[model samples]
Target: MDVTSDEVEMETAPVSADELVEAMRQAADDAGFDLEPEQLEVARRLGSLAVGEASVPAHLYLWGAAGRGKTWLLDAYFQALPTERKRRVHFHSFFRALHRSIHEHRTAAAEAARATGEPGAGARAAAGAVANAVDRAVEDLLDEVDLVLFDEFHVHDPGDGTLMIRLLEALFSRDVSLITSSNYPPSGLLPDPVYHHIFEPGIAVIEANMTVVELAGDTDHRRSSAVQRRQGFSRGTWMLTGQEADDELADLGLPRPDAADAVTMAISGHEFRASAARGGVLWFTSAELLERPTSVGDYLAWAAEYDRWVLDALPAPEHLTREARARFVHLIDALCDLDVELHVIAATDRETFMTAETLGRGGFARDAFRTRSRLALLRTVG
Candidate 1:
């Protein structure tokens, strides 16, 4: 196949690791995300090696606690890149695309077998067709881009486990660079013991080939704005009786309560439904919060949609394990970074919510939790 001029240029253009690192720093600064010196150094090294025609490392695994700006930095790096040479995709979205491609191929193969009158050939033909479809999808993904940036690299489904290993092998063979960010270390992913070995080869490849950089720092940039809000904040405690709060919310142009009793608002092109739970609290789900990029832009969009947020229940620390807790903190940081104000009306005391047993037992280091907890308090108050 004749590669496009753009692809040729990507294949030949020399990308400086240091320059890319500097660009990332500038981008972070532009986005108001503070980067530590060591983090910048690690990014510089990765940038230096991330591009080039040599048989570079097959995979680069960037793992850290949430709210450390891993995704932001990676995105900054990706966006600053000459667009023709890179592709950035969330794992879930990519997998869904891949799944659709697989299904299409299977359907085509079954039709071909039927037209040929090949008795009992549909199953085998479809299987081969699916494999070929996956291979082609992988090829196309690599063909146009030298570097693949996968955000939120996670393996919840066993089927995806097999696909990921295969996909990485193919990309490595093609000399395409893979950069991924995840909440879990490579070794700790896909924790089901039975399927753990499926991920081992990919993990080993990443460890040997790419530099594993940890973004260690104190500030949760996501919460910075919320902290600022709390620093110079004062709000009267106004009790809105159920009817009064409802009427006030309605007057503010929020959705009228549905027959099913859900208050729905559109935020950043996504719909979020909040329902009054016990003790007059409102609840938002993780699925709702993570449906789109939780960037500053998105947060501003959300602010226009709803005047006030009432979280009857924040994500309980117990609801998440250590890895999950870190991820949530990162999300909260993103929300804070966007200046999304939160108001919680809970039956439980603030201390009880802040110091839940789940919070204590989760494997987060004390210092990290302390920093995050302070931010959480600020967000709740706002």
Candidate 2:
């Protein structure tokens, strides 16, 4: 266990399919998950296909409920592969990168058109530039990468769904293999009946080209007993004087403020500040602590940098309108995705306010309320 840096590097070898599956099993066991036989079989088959000689298919879809090890399986498989052969990214980050690439391509194309005698060619040039950018991004992503693993692959907007289709079409043409995990199957994605047709072709391609695996089990490995222990509870209030808190933060290896107005701290690699509170509360909101659309790297950084977080407020379920509540719920869900411990020292006990009746009154079903309550408990206490 005491692996030196050199020894650690030496120990890292390309993981075989069997090794990958075994590692998944071990991780499941460690997290107190009881894998069903079917789940195990899927893992074995996925490992085999991933390591097989055949060129990877256009797509591979693994869909199941939250905490069913869909993400875990894909992550384990990706980690097992040779580093150069894989790129694991959340769908949002990938889309943002793709969008930026498209923008750059369009800008270049515009510049080129401006320099040439081509009038009215700007639009066509821009379109071609976008296509090329998409192609190049897909190519770079697929370059040397035998498999691409995308986690939380869900389309909430029409624009995103269209972009996904185009991206997949390009990747498929190039024969780049894709493995994606989602809460719902391809057909169920973007559940609006109106836009279902738009998503149909993409879903058909996914179904035809990729093996569908479902790990239908009640146990959420992320919330398993062992994981709970590792994550620890987020509770208690650290009531220290302004100066005391500042000094303690420095002692704990966090940034200390020499002036009260400006407080500098880094969360997930992006540095931002909470204007020092006039009351010396130095309150932290989940929004302030977790910038929206955070990356896995950012999550890891936040987890390592802060063992315990003191928050003055958490967005309450009742205070938000339906859409707003859903967004906040999604945000909390994302926080759980990061697995960071949160310690809330709020003025009000928001925990007690999340009740079945309150949720019912708020227009949420009892079961939905219960699920959200459980997740909230995990966020508040875990």
Candidate 3:
């Protein structure tokens, strides 16, 4: 089926639910996803939602293993939805922007409280200010957005569980519908036993308000796939550090920094050690990146500034601190989301680098599954 841009735009203009399913089928083909039975079921359900079918729930929570096509199905359907009032956000950048905006609102609110010239005014206003900050931030972030698609959603961090609850509440209050994909089911989120109970209320809201579906397929699709694209992360490679990796870098005419080329640069109020910038390429060792407290926002900032990134001297995952391992996962996530070219050099094979023992505790197991799947797109040199 040859779909013209005009036809796509026409489809987007308030199609019937039946017509929208046809549009969604076209979207799946365009996205190059082989629609499994489970995926098709979810996609059809999501398509039915474009027209707000009365029988359809207001929100959807699709959960599955990383390679089960949860993200692909949701994204493809989102593109085909017949509405301009929709927003799609990746979890990392979405949370980063949310945190930043809430902080900005709270600062302004606190300043106003201070200027009132009343004793304990700032202290007294802090509670209400937080609520206002959340409301204002959500209002700004989701202006006229009736539908939101949240990709790669997870609440692994204990500290973030509360934040997620607040965000869900805000979205509910505004009557904004949501479609989200996640590696874990609602009960499996924030898997830290100590903090699991704290998210129960949030889970209850989801259970009450959203339709939950599991896309359970046997295949690890990413692991079985080969690189078919010449741009973006698909064009990248994973290789053991050696002359072979260096030769490929030279063949691609990409930058590879020597010790003398490394330098420290400040970005987004955080310092990062990188190779001397060459055109749009930047290089850093795993230690320089993962050993520090660099945030997902910092990775996003760097990925934005540099089109290509080279990561070298990646140690075994077992050797790194849990924090460092988590940082690497976030780094891969940000880079993959932006489709930034990344060349990673590791000391061992991907399997050995991501052993069960290496991933340790918390929600790292599932999160690592996602990171590993993304890396599987990279060309591997044994």
Candidate 4:
């Protein structure tokens, strides 16, 4: 849970948002994607801002329902920007890196205090190191970047509340133009009534500095008959018993490991038994994935090593323990972000599998819609 994978900030050329949208239409014409009017209008506005033809606050925060093309619009805009000093990072990856960097910085400072000594991820350290560590983390992430785009931005974890505000302060202070794609608006982040206050300051920063845009729509057009491709996660299967998935696995030369010979695997720093394991392939029961104190960082670590993941005996979320159910939702988010395969053998039908939530007052309901939308990228069979 200590390490997470992130897209390295890219070094590339820039174009205008409107031009990028035109290119998208041309390339994806086969999918009948004309570039929705709502998104196009947003693109023009972004282009205007890029050219100084329009003035907004500090940046943009595009949010609304899942499948509303918030990400698509942001991605296109990223490619179209006029400066080469832009970087795009998945927020979770940045978060993990920031955490690791902070710990390292803190430990170093504490060690300096040791002889002066230090406190670290693997070492002993001091409390004054915390503030200095955060400062260093912000500097490391921002560097010379003039613009940054953070995808899937949300604040569900109260632990991230203060960190989020601090990071935002650094970005705004450095005049880093920001764009984010999220299912939640600034007000909706960290929606748990108990924890929402923790993020209120960060929310205020977002509301004050970013132009909030809503891109609402019905229907996930990506799952339309014309667009869904047979690739990546789509190459995976969801079925009753995983028989079809097994055959495909074997046919592709990575046969599933037998349950009797469960394989012990190391994720980040923890050890757990997989239902089976082979070359870049791993199998697990839903319990194996969800029942423990595993985190999204752990999921990402394994994903970096394995190309395929098979999850069996996936029960209804309502039937799972609160912690277990939350892990499942996090697992989905992690997998969706990676270029890996997920073959699910559900204990219930897809309807129930998709709709079920952990029985609780506060959980991952906010993430469910995004989870289902991304899961649609994969092919499902009854």
Candidate 5:
């Protein structure tokens, strides 16, 4: 566990992944996580990877149940790594960016072919141009990062699955080291029966390029029975409709979100315009946060960075479309996972909010239940 300054500062020298994991474990323990025995063993395996002790594959792919600390471990490992050219990304956001890049590249390639008087350069030239564009995009995007780590890896879109094959090939060819955490095994990716084959090649790439490590566990540590009561969940009696909610927030020393100005946030190259953000506290209306096509990855990124969040005009699930409600569930899950202090201005009293007619409506019903549970812990302020 006693890593020297040289080990921590190994400029251009490769440090064993086990050493990084060991350091990460110590840091997590110091920060109060009860280090499970299996977690330590897995860290050792990951460290073995950093040192080339593993013979088959060099990259790492860790998978387990939700809330099993796969993200937590990757976070720690990413922080502990001394490598300067390392990047950590939420997998969903990464794919979103990748999709955009692919489109942009294909468009540019088409434009280039047209400029050369080959508007009908035919399929072969067009294909060659696209391939070159993909190469350029990948090179430019990852020009700075030698190691790329992805959290919450999943393949739900067939488009993303197809793109993954090319992206992974490019990264592997460049010898970019990889570390990923996922809920599903590579074989379990894109479980949609109809379009799963689109990702088969991508899955094969993962199998060939990474050493899959399973972190088996049952309990979700984030929601453990013995979870320590945390600060920052607060509620009020009055519906968060008018001036009353502002008064309540002022009483709790939080900013008045209505009067506060808006700020734009760019996550994974996508623009997210927030209604109010101040002093590391971000504020949003229910519509702004949920009605849009926001994913948990965006929330996760924000939660990791911001210490406080204020969500005003949080509507009951009944008031929202199914998609909006599902997104709300995802937001709560990310906040709980990161243990971020959340201040909400709910439309109704705490009890009514939990028992709304739309409570158990969607595929996210379980997430809704957990969100309600976490919300219950918030202090009622009015």
Candidate 6:
């Protein structure tokens, strides 16, 4: 991923982060959005830092309320950058892949050691194996990318929080530049005060490694944009959980899922049972979709095939486990990304759904925030 000097010069010549952001402001205005002063300030700072040609580029942590254009700004900066060794990814997907790679390496090493019939791969040896595996995995995962742009970064699970420290340390060691957008500030991450200390190391690393820019605008750009450009996303419903939900289904000419005739789909040679399937429409319960250890890959596969999805009985996150909440976020993200016509039936109404107790708790906030932000674009009918 070579950063051609000519290209760099063209983008960074004299244009500062401030200037670039101002340009973005004008563009937004042209698109009927009045950019806030705070957004412009943050963008200016980001633009200036982004032009550095140092070996280890300065990193940035952009944080603010949801829908303040943090992602929009970072996206513009990412595209304008002259480097070919850049990757922009959703934080959840990136970490999932990271964990998967580490697990694969560690498991393979352990299996190989066991198969070799060698004695004394004891606890200490196992620890060493894990460390070595992590090193290799980090290297492999970041082999070519010099700049990684993570959208909606947050840590809730202790395992993920702990891993963040290691990941930050590893990335710093390799001099990899990072640009992440989040709804939390450096001090505000992992906001559960009881578990906040668990991520101290990661937080410290972030503070030392990146410049923090807070985008504290009052308006949510996505919500406003949705209202202004509220087309394309249509045929959605916010229905009641039981009888009314069934009635809505009937109104839409959808059949009730039969227990005796469950529909199943296969992905990667593994069978995944669905509540119901008809034509290209699929039905799933919140429990089946979120309670299971489903990956984004599963949703991606389904999204590719299904034109319509009916997610029924979404229990407000209180009853859901942490993993379930995370999966729900991933599910919504996948469907939104694929632009699937989504019809949902929940115990609660749309107003209360986004700010549910579970969504506001722990690291789920960022994902929930993003889910809600994207949901704003969706057309809703009661």
Residue pairs of candidate 1 with colliding backbone atoms: 17-47, 17-48, 66-330, 67-330, 222-333, 222-337, 282-312
lDDT of 1 by residue, 163-216 (tens): 777777677677678888876788877766778887888777667766677777
Spell out the clash pairs found in candidate 3.
none
TM-score per model over all chains: 0.62, 0.67, 0.88, 0.85, 0.68, 0.76
By lDDT: ranked, best first: 3, 4, 6, 5, 1, 2
lDDT tens string, model 2, 87-111? 6765644665676678888988988
Which scores higher on TM-score, 1 or 3? 3
lDDT digits (tens) for residues 287-376 of candidate 3: 888897788878876776888888889987777888888888888888987789989889988767876564556525757678888888
Candidate 4 segments whose C-alpha is farther than 4 A from its true place: 1-31, 51-57, 114-125, 223-227, 242-245, 252-254, 259-261, 357-364
lDDT, candidate 4, at 278: 65
lDDT of each: 0.57, 0.56, 0.75, 0.70, 0.66, 0.70
For all the candidates, what are their Cα RMSDs to the real structure? 8.8, 7.4, 4.6, 4.0, 6.7, 5.3
C-alpha displacement of 114 in model 2, angstroms? 5.1
lDDT of 5: 0.66
Which is the leading candidate under TM-score?
3
| Candidates ranked, most accurate by TM-score first | 3, 4, 6, 5, 2, 1
Stretches off by above 4 angstroms in model 2 are: 1-20, 27-34, 50-52, 55-59, 81-84, 111-121, 221-312, 333-382
